[model samples]
Target chain A: MELLDFARGPALQFALAVFVLGFLWRIVSLFLMPRTKDRSAARPGTRPALFAATREIIRRTAPDKAFGKHSLFALVNGYVFHVGLFIVIIGFAPHIVFFRDLLGVAWPSLPNNVIYAAGVITIASMMVALVRRFLNPVQRLISTLDDYFSWLVTFLPVLTGLLANSHLWVRYETLLAIHILSVELFLIWLPFGKLMHLALVFVTRSQIGTHLAHRGAQI
Target chain B: MTREINVQAAANRFLAQISGNLGAYMEACLHCGHCADACHFYAVTDDPRYTPAYKLFPMARTYKRSKPPLSWFGGAPKVTEKDLQEWEELLFDSCTMCGRCTMVCPMGIDIASIVAASRQAFVAAGLGPPDLLQAAENARDKGSPLGVSADVLADRVEWLADDNEVDIPLDKEKADVLLTVSSIELMKYPDSLVAMAKLLNHAGIDWTLSSKGYEATNFGFLSGRSDIAKIMIQRIVDAAESVGAKTVVIPECGHAYGVLRWAGANILGKPLPFEVVHITEFLADLKRRGKLKLKPMGDAVTYHDPCQISRRGGATQAARDLLDGFATDFREMTPTGNHNWCCGGGGGVQAMSRAAGLRHKVFKLKMDQVEQTGADTMLSACANCRLTMDESKEHWHWDKDLGSLVEVLAEHIDESNAAA
Candidate 1:
C-alpha cells in the first residue's frame, strides 16, 4: 500500500481505536480503584471544596508566587508550548476543517499566518524543554525512558505537521502522510505514557486543592 | 543478610492505601523537578534523590503496575526488597513530609501526603524505622511517646501551681476547655505550661488538664498508622467528652494541632464533639474580641511558621495577627506563612536517630532563612519546631534566642488584664 493510503486508512483507524479504548480503560480502572474515604471535616463557612478545586485548576497552571522566579524558564516555556499547541490543534483553519469533517463540529479558525507562527513557537519551546531535560542534572535524574519517549512522540507531530503544511523538502501528500502517522503514534502512546497528564492534570490539581481547602488551607 | 520483604504484600498495601487524590497525583506528575527548589532537603544538599518527585519513584512504579493499559503490557518496573530499603531512607529519613513541596508544585500534587502513604507501605513491609516504631509503640501502650507518666504530669502541674501561685486544674469536671500539651513541653519546657495556666487564669476561662489525655503529640499520625493515631487521639477525645468541655486547646505543638484539628474527625469517623483550637488561634481569637490584652515587646522577632500549624492546619493568619498584636518589631521570614520551609525535623524525623545527620544538613536552609532576617529572637508556635531550631542554633553556633509564642505572650501579659 502507498504510504498516504496506509496513513489515511488502517493506521488512522488503529490509532483512534487505541486512543479511545486505551483512555476509556485507563480512566475507568483508575476511577474504579478503591479510594480511601476523606472523613476530615470541611473548613467552616467557606466556599465549597469543588469551587476551590476549580480555582486551583486555573491557579496552579501558572507559577506559584513562592517559586515563580526560580521556575520562570520552565513556566514560561511550558505555558508557551501548551497554549501554542492548543492553537495549532484546535484553532488552525486546516485542523478545524479536519475536525469538522471528522466530527461534524466547527469553530472559527485563526489566520494561516498566525497558525504558522504558533506552530513555530511551539516547536521552539519543545526544543528548549527537551534540551533542559537532558542538560539539567535534577531533571535528568528524575526523567525516565517514558519521559523522553513521550517528548519525542509529542514533538514529532508538530515538526512534521509544520513541514507538511509548509510543503518543504517533500511532496505535500507525502509530508502530510508522515505528519498523520506521527500524530497517530502520539495518540497511541498518549494513554500509556507520561502524556496521560493531558487528562490527569485536572484530576490531580483539583484533588490537591479540594483536600487543602477542606483543611482550611488557602491553596 | 537482609530480612525477607514481601514485595507483593508491600505493593498490595500501597495500592490499598491509594486514595483518588493519590492515584491522580501519581498519574499526573510531570516529573518536572520544580518541587526540588521547595524541598529543604534537596535545596540544601543538592541531592537529586532527595527531590520530592524522585522520592515518589518506587510508589509510582508500583502504582503503574496496578494501573490498566500499562498493566496489560507489564513493562513497569518491579518493586523489590532492595527498592523498599532505599525508599525507606528517601521517604522516612530524608523527607520530612513537609508540605512546602506541595505548595510549589505546578501540578498541585501533594507529594508529602504520598510520602506518608509510602511510609505506611514501609510499615506494612515491616521496614519502618525502629525509632518511629518504638515511639508509636510508646504512644499506643504507654500513653505518651516520651513515656511521661501520669504521675510525672501531676507532679509538674503541682510544681507549676506552687511556683506560680496559680491554680493548676487537673481532671476538673465540666470545664469550658480541656487543655492538652505535648510531652516535649512537659519535659523540655515546663514553663510553657506555667504560661498557659497563668493566661487561662488571667482570662478567667474554665480549663483543666486531664491526666488521662493531656499528652497531645500523636506518634501514630506521624508514623502513618491511622489505627494507632486514632487510639492516641481518642484518649484526648474521651477526656474532653468526659469533662463536657466545649473546646480542646492544643498547645504550641504543630503535629498535635495537625492531628486534633485536621485528622481528628476522620479518626473518630464523625465530627469531634468539641471544637479544636490551636493555642495561637485561641489566643488570637481572644485578642480579636478584646478579651485578652498584651503588652507590646520592642525586640525584633521573626516567627517560624510550623508546617503542620500554618501550611497544613490553616493557622497562619492567627499566628501573624497575634504577633502583630504583641511585637512592635515583628520581622517576616522570606517565604513565611504557609510557604515556610520546615525546620528539618517534622513527621517523626526528629525521633529517628538515623536521620539526625541528614536532618541537620537540611536545617541549614532554615538557618539561612532565619539569619537573613537578622532577628535576635526566633519564635515559633510548635514545640517540635522550637526543639529543632534549638538544635539548629547549637549546631550552627548561632546566638539567637529561641522562644515560644506562648511563653513570649506569658512574659508580656497585660498587667491590667491580669487584674481583671
Candidate 2:
C-alpha cells in the first residue's frame, strides 16, 4: 500500500532501463549520421551551442500573429493537449504523494478535479489530431503506422486515467495501475518517437538562430 | 483554338507521381504553425490564407480520407465540381513554393514539395497561373522561356566574345564545363552572360553552353509534374554528356540551381559524374583560390537570400563570401541563411502575371530589410532574385542597385589579358 513500493517495483525499473538506453541510442544515431559537407568554409562551430541558439530559435519560431482562419482549433487544441499532459505528468496527486513519501519532498499536486479536466482535454485534443490526420488526404499519405500508434500510446494513458477516475467498470486500484503503466510506457517511448522533438526542438531552434546570427541577421 | 481540359486524368496522374515521397511528408505535419512566420507571403501580407499549411489543406484532406468509409464522408476536396476551379487557382497561383517554410517546419514537412505537388495537380486541371502555364507550355514547345530564336542566341554569344581572341563555340564538342543559363539571362540580362563569359575567359576555363540544352529553366518545377520536370532536365543532362562536360554551371536562378544541383543526381541516374555548381559557387571557388579579386564597393551593402540558392540549393553563403569583397557595412536581414525569407518570384511567380501584385507585396519584406540597413546596393546570388529585386526597386522606387553577384564580381576581376 506504500507509495515507495510502486516506485521501487520491477515494472518501473524495467521501463526506466529501456527508456534510458533507447533514448541514448537514438541521440547517438542522429549524432553519428553523415552531415552535409560544408562547401563554403564558414565554419559552423564544433561544440554545439545548445542554450544560446535555442533562445534565438524560440524567438523566431514564435508565431508573429495568430494562425490563419479556422486554424485556432488546431492551435488551441494542441496547446491544451501539451499543457494539460504536462500538468498530469508532474502534478498528478499520486505522483506527488509517492514522491513525498519516498523522496521526503514533493511538488504541489493539481486538485483531483483539475487532473480530471487535464485528462479530458488531452483525450479531446488527441482525437481531433487523429481525425484531422485521417480525414485529410495529404496528411493521411504522409502518416505512417507508427504515427497512428503514437497517437494511441499518447491518448490511451489519458483515456485510462479518466476511466480510473470514473471507477465505473473496473476497480479503482486496477484501473489506476493500468494508467501508471501506460504513463511508464509512454515515457519510455518519448525519446524514440516524434515526441523526441520535445528535447531536439531547442537544438534546431538554436542552430537556426546561431547560424543566422553568424550571418549578421538582426531577426 | 481551344482544347477541352482533362481534369480528372491530369489529377490522377499527378497524384500517382507524387503520392510516394510527398505523401510521406504530408502525413508528418502536426500543424505546429512554426512555418507560418517563415513564409514570405504570410510574413509580408499577414494573410493566414497564404500560409504554406493552408495551401496544402485541400490536398491533405483529400489524401487522408480517400479510402473506404472515410471516402463516403467526402474526406478530400477535388478540382472537379463547382468552386473546384477556385481552389485550384488558390493552391497554384497563391503559393510560390519557395521552401523557406520547409526549413522551419518542426516535422521537416518539405512544404515546398507539397505546394509543388498541389500546383502540379492544378496544372493537371489546367488551373495553373496563366502566365506560368504559358511559360511552361512555351518552354515545353520552344526550348526557351522567352521563345528566343537560335539566331538571337548566336548574336548574344557573339556579343559576349572578344573579336581578337578564341571563338566562343556554338556547339562545341567535349568541353570540361557545360554552362547553362536562365531564360532571363538569355533574353533580358545579357550582362550576366557577358559576365559569365568574361569569368570563363579570364580563368581559361574550358566550358561550352549547349545550343541544344542552352536553357536553364525547367517548367516541370512550375507545373509540379515530376515527369515534365524529369523530361526538361533530361535535355540538359543529354547535352552535358554529349560534350563530356566534367562540370555544369547552372546560372543564378534559384530553381535553375536547385534543378541542376539537387535534381541532377536523381534524373541522371547517379550523382552527376560532372560536378554541378551554381555560377555563384563557381565564382566563390575562384574567389577562395584568389583567382578572382573584386574592387570593394566600399558602400553599405545588403544581401537578399534567394530561397532556391539558400535553402533548396545551399549556395547562399558562397555568394556572401564573394559579396564581402565590396561591402563596407554588410548588414543581413533578421532571418538569413537557410531560414531566410523568399524573393517571392520563385516557383514561376515572376512569370505568373496574375501573381505579380502578390509577388511585389511579398517582396516588401526583403525590401524593407534592405532599406533599414541603409544599403545603397543589394547583391543576390540567384538570377530570379536579381530580377525580382530590380522589379521591386522599379515598382516601389527603392533606390538601390540590384546586381547579380557575378556581374558585381566581374567588375572587380584584378587580372587582365596581359597579366594572365
Candidate 3:
C-alpha cells in the first residue's frame, strides 16, 4: 500500500512533469531552430500547405505502393501494437481513473476484459517487433541503445499491467504499483529517446507533406 | 601522409543544412527497416550500409550534438574528417538522392535531403567523386560541365540546324521563353534538343537557346557545391533577364528543371523574374492550350519518371499527360507517379569510376521494373536517365529501345500545325 501511494503520488508527478517539459522543450527547439526557408514562389497545390501537412498525421498510418510484402508486414505489425497501446492507455478504466486524478477530467472507459486483451496483444506485438528488430539487418544496423531501453520501458508497463489485471505472477497491490512505476519510467524516458517519435512523427511528416504541397503535390 | 580536412568547418556546414524540420526528422526515425526496402541501393546490394537512414548518421549526430541533453552527453563526438572520407561513397555513389525513401518513410522524413546535407559536408571536407568536383569547376570555368563552351554550343546549334534542316535559333534577344539546353543533350543526345525545337516550333512559342547560359545540367548540384550550383543557375537567370524573357524552358534534364523550379530563388535568395518550366511541362501546357497538334505514336510506350523531375519536382503528370497525348499504348511501371524508382545513375553515380559496379548492379532493379512494363520503348524526360538506361539496356541486351520523351513526340509531331 505504501509503495502504491509513493508510485501514484510523487513518482507519477515527477515523471509527468519531466515528460511534459521535455516534450515541449524538444518540440519548441525544433520549431525555433534555424530552418531553411523556401523563399521561391510556390506553385499552389490542390489545397493549402498547412492543410496538407495536417492531413499527413492521419495519412501516414498506411504504407504507400512502394512498400513491398515484408515492408507491409513491418508496417501492419507496427499498427497492431500501436492500436493496442492506444486502447490500453486511453480506454482502460484504471488508466482513465489515473488521468482523471491528474487532470480532474474523466471519460467513459472500456470493460476490464477488453483492456486486458489489448494489453496482451500490445505486449505480444511489441515482442514480435523486437524480435524483428534483432533479426532484420537494417533495423539492427541503425538501432541504438536508446531503442532497446525505450522498448524495455514501454514493455514493462504492459507486462506489469497485464499481470496486475490477471493476478497471476505477483500480489495484486505489488503488481499494480510496479505497473504504475514502469509507466512512470516510460514517461521519463519518452522525450530523451527515439520514443520521442510519438510526437515528432507528426512534426517531420507534416513538414514533408507541406513541402510537397509547396512544390505543387500532395502527400 | 594523408591530408586531413578541417573537421570543425565541415561540422559547421553540416549544422547549417539542418533545414526543413531535419531536427525533427533526425529525432523521429524509428529505424523500422522499411526505408531499406524503398532504397534501390540496399535492395540491390543487400548491404546494411546502403540503408537510407544509416547514411544520415553523421548528420544526425551533428544535429543531436547541437541540441540539449544529447549535446551535454559528449556532444555526440563531433563528426571527424575520417567519417567524411568514409561517407563520401555512401553520400555520393551509393545514393542518388532519388527521394523514394522520402516518399516511403512512415515519419515522412526527407532522407534524401538529409543525405544531400551530408553530401554538402562531404564537399566542405574536399571529399566527393572527382568527376563531379571537376565538372563543377568546369561548369564555372567553362560554359558547360561537359566542356561545351560558348563556341562549342554555337557550333553544335549551327550544325544541328543545318543537318536537321530545323530552325534552331540561338542567342536571340527579347524572346518570350529562354530555352536552356542540358549539356547531355548538347553533347550526347542532340536529337532531344532537335525534338524540343520541333515541338516548340510547332507550338509557335517565341523561344531561343542562350549562348551565354545554354548548358542546363548543374554538376554542382550533384557534387553538393551550393556555391557552384548557384553560379551555374545564375548564368541562366542572367541570360533570361538580359533577354527580358518572360519564361525559361529547362531542357529534358531532371535536376536542371529541379534547380530552376524549386531551389533557384532559394539558392539566389530572391524570386526569379520569370517562370521556369520543364520541356515536358512546357509541352503539357502547349497541349492544354491546344497549341501543338499531335498524332498517336503507334507503339507500346512506357514512361520513366526522373527522380528530381517527378518525385521531388512535382511535375509528375506533365510527362504522363504528354505521353497520353501521343502514346497509343502507355503502360506505367507498377508503382508509377511520385512513387517511381530511380535510374541508379543520378547524383553523379554515372561519373564515378569506383561506383560503376554498384551503379550497374542497381540498374538491374530499374531494368526489372521496365521489363515488367513490357513496353517496346521506354521513354524518359531527363537525358541523364535516358543515357543511364540506354547503357544498361545495352548491357542486359534489352530488346526495348530507350528514347527521350521529347524525341518520341517530335517524331510523331504534326508539322502542319507548326508556327509560321
Candidate 4:
C-alpha cells in the first residue's frame, strides 16, 4: 500500500486501538490498586468529600493565588497550548468532518482563520514549553528523556497539522498524511508517557481534594 | 554495587503505604517545577534537590519500574543506595512534610504525602534518620521522647498545681476531658501547662492529666513508622478510655494534635470513643459556650497558625475566635490560616540535631512573614512552632516576644466568676 493509504488505514487504526486499550488498562490498574482507607473522622457540618473533590478539579484549572506569581509562565503557556490544541482538534472544519465520519456526530466548526490562529498559538506555546524545559535549571533537572520525547510527539501533530492546512512546502495530501501519522504517534505515546496526565489530572485532583476536605481544609 | 539493597522490598513497602490516588499523582505530574517555589527549603537554599517533585522522584522511579506499561520497558531507573542516601536528607531534613507543596501544586499532587510514602520505605529499609528513629524508640519504651519519666511528669504537675493553688488531677477517673501534653510543654514550656491548668480550673471543667498517656507527641508518626505510631496512639486511647473522658485535649504541639486528632482513628483502626480536640479548640469552645470568660489584652499581637493545627487539624477558626475574644489588637500575618508557612521544626526535624542548620536556613521564610506582621508579640498554639520561633529569634537576635496563645489567654482570664 502507498504511504498515505497505510498512514490513513493501518497506522490510524493501530493508534486508535492502542490509545483506547492502553487508557483502559492504565485506568483499570489505577482502580485495581489498593486504596488506603481514610479512617479519620469527617469534619462536621461540611460538604461531602466528593463535593470538595469535584470543586478542586474545577478550581485548580486556574492559577491559585498562593503560587500565581511563580507559576505565571507555566499557567499561561500550559493554558494557551491546551486550549489551542482543543480548538484545533475539535473546532477545525476538516477535523469536525473526520470526527463525524468516525463517530457519526456532527458539530459546528469555527472559522478557518480562528482554527489557524489556534494552531499557530499552540505551536508557539509548545515551543515556549520546550525552551523553558531546556533553559530552567530546575525544570531541566526534573525532566527525563520521556518528558522530552512526549513534548516532541505532542508538538509535531499541531505543527504538521498547521503545515498541512497551510499547504506549505509539500503537497496538501502528503502533508495531511504526515499530520495524521504524527497524531497517531502521539496517541500511541499518550498512555505510556507523561501525557497520561490528561486523564489522571482529574482523578488526582479530586482525590487530593477529598483527602484534604476529610481533614476539613479547603483546597 | 557491592552493597546489597533490597530495592524490590522497599518498592513493595512504598506501594503498600500509598493509595490509588497516589498512582494518579505520580502519573499526573508534569514536572512543571511550580512546587519548588512552594517549598521553604528550596526557596531559602535554592537547591533543586529540595524541590517537592524532586523529593518524589525516587518513589516515582520505583513506581514506574514496578507498575504497568512502563514496567514493560525495563521500568524506571533502579532504586540505588545513592538514591536512598540522597533522598534521606531530601525527604526528612530539608522537607518538613508541611503539605504546602501539596496545596500549591497545579496538578494537585500531594507531594508531601508522596514524600511520606518514601519515608515509610526508608524506614522499612532501615534508612530513616537516626535521631528520629532513636526518638521513636524512646517514645515506644519510655512513654516520652524526651525521656522524662512518669514520676518526673507527676512532679511537674504537682509543682504546677501547688504553684497555681489548684489540684492537678493525675489519672483521675471519669473526667470530662483528658488533657494530654507534649514533652516540650512539660519540659521547655511548663508555663503553657500552667496556663491550661488555670483555665481549666477557672472554667470549673472536670479535666485530668493522665500519667499513662501524658505525652502527646508521637515520634513514630514523625519517623513514618505506622507500628510505632499505632502504639503511641493506642496508649493515649487507652488512657482516655480508662479515664472515661468525653474529650481528649491535645496540648499546643502541632504534630501532637495531628497525631491524635487526624491519625488517631486510622491508627486505632476504628473511630475514637471520645472526641479529640486541640487546646485552642477546647478553649474556643468554652468561650463560645460562655463557660469561660477572659479580659481583653490590649497588646498588639499576631497569631501564627501552626501548619498542622490549622491546615491539618481544621482548628483555624477556633484559634482565631479565641484570639479575637481576648486580644483587642489582634493582627493577622499575611497568608495566614491554612497557607501559613511552617516554623521549620515539625516532622521530628526539631529532634534531629543534624537537621538544625537546614531547619534554621528554611526558617527565614517564616521569619520574614512574622516580621512583616509588625507585631512585637507573636502568639502560636503549637509548642513546636513556639520553640522553633524562639530558636530563630535567638539565632537572629530578633527582638520579638514569642508567646503561647494559651499562656496569653491565661494571663488575661476573667477571675470575677471565681467567687461563684
Winning candidate number (lDDT): 1
Tens-place lDDT per residue, model 3, B74-162, is 54656777777777778898988888887678889988778777788878876778788898899989988889999998899899999
lDDT of 2 by residue, A1-219 (tens): 544347348667777787777767645644454433223222234234454465566664544332334344655666678898888777888778867875799987888888888888788888988897787443554454446767788887888878988896788777777877886788676655556666555444554444433323323
lDDT, candidate 4, B123-205, per-residue tens: 88768778889999888888888887789888898898898776788988779899998898888998888899889988889
TM values, all candidates: 0.96, 0.71, 0.97, 0.97
Q: How would you order the candidates by DockQ, starting with the best? A: 4, 3, 1, 2
Q: lDDT by residue for model 1 over A82-119, one digit each (tens)?
A: 99999999988888888998899999999989999999
Angstrom error at residue B204, model 1: 1.3
Residue-level lDDT tens digits of model 3 in A102-190: 78999999998889889988988999999988998888988877779889999999999888889988789888989999999999988
TM-score of chain A taken by itself, candidate 2 = 0.79
Scanning candidate 3 chain B in windows of ten residues, the lowest lDDT window is B69-78
Q: List the residue pairs that clash in candidate 4.
A: B252-B383
For candidate 1, give fnat to 2 decimals.
0.72
User: How good is model 3 by TM-score?
Assistant: 0.97
Instruction: Please say which candidate is ahead in lDDT: 1 or 4.
Output: 1
DockQ scores for all the models shown? 0.68, 0.08, 0.70, 0.72
Candidate 4: residue B182 lDDT (0-100): 87
User: How would you encode candidate 2's per-residue C-alpha lDDT over B205-288 as one tens digit per residue?
Assistant: 788888778788787677665666766777887888899998888887888877666655555455555677778888778777
For candidate 2 chain B, the 10 contiguous residues with the lowest summed lDDT are: B66-75
Predicted structure 2: lDDT: 0.67
Point out where model 1 deviates above 4 Å: A34-36, A68-70, B1-4
Per-residue lDDT over A47-166 for candidate 4, one digit per residue giving the tens place of the 0 to 100 score: 787788889999988776568365677778888999999999999998889899989999999999999999999988999999988888789899998899999999999989888888
